[model samples]
Target: MGEVLQKRFPDMVALFTGLGFLTVLAELVLMDHREGIRILAPLAAGLGAGAILLGLGFPRGRVWATGLLLLVGGMGLLGLVEHMQEALEASSPSVVRLVDEEGWEYPAYPGPLREGEKEGSPPPLAPLALSGLGLLGALALHARKP
Candidate 1:
């Protein structure tokens, strides 16, 4: 198994990168974009695509691919930090009013809103997936026998 993986590492990396890119793109589209950070949605998608292309050997160079992968990884780390900060800042305790089916209204205390549940936020851990994939590709490229 180890030998097989070592020999087919590039193909595996390419396949996983393409799948991850598609998944991220679909998720971004589904999550929709806020006016403030709308540009970031497309930017992330573009970067993911570029990484996929590099992983798939489209341009055929390890150094270029490694650089792009590292860049993507860094962006993911930045995003994770931003998301955690936003979540922390918005986590003050609060009471929300709820209306029941019987048309009765009551004050309900709820836990802090999660990452993407808040307005204009992305999932807290979503960026980590990008980071992991990027780092994995970079490391795989570096480790593969030339």
Candidate 2:
């Protein structure tokens, strides 16, 4: 089943990988020198679709697994965009200035999905991080038979 799934859903894997890479690179390309905003909504959609493909267990919990995986992966993409932006900003060339720009509307999307950062460490991206987990999980269950 896993092998069948892998063959049938190659695009799903590709989509997941692409979303992961693009979201990470968004800050490098679009917004500020902090630097950019790449189109991420489509990527989010892709991940959701990939998740559904992944959680499609053979005869056991196939439907429910597919649905939940889809939901988790889809939501992860949105969260990644929001969380990645915050991370990139903190890791930006002007990290200090950007961080100090008081009352700023984040100038992008929401800031960090989790609370706190290192004294100087770039912000942690738990949300963005989860997307990878989803990807790996999907990949791992590429062709689950049962």
User: lDDT per model, in order?
Assistant: 0.70, 0.49
Residue runs of model 1 more than 4 Å from their true location after superposition: 1-5, 58-60, 93-122
Q: List the residue pairs that clash in candidate 1.
A: none
TM-scores, all candidates, are 0.67, 0.34
Error of 1 at 108 (Å): 8.4
| Winning candidate number (lDDT) | 1
Model 2 lDDT per residue over 58-107, tens place: 44544554454445565566666676666776666333323445655434
Candidate RMSDs in order: 6.9, 13.5
- How do the residues 47-91 of candidate 1 rate in per-residue lDDT, one tens digit apiece? 766766665565467678777777878877877887787777766
Distance from true position, residue 44, model 1, in Å?
A: 2.6
Regions of candidate 2 where Cα sits further than 4 Å from its true position? 1-59, 88-126
**Full-model lDDT, candidate 2:** 0.49
Q: Residue 66 of model 2: what lDDT?
A: 49
**Which residue pairs show collisions in model 2?**
1-143, 2-143, 2-144, 3-143, 30-36, 30-37, 31-35, 31-36, 31-37, 32-35
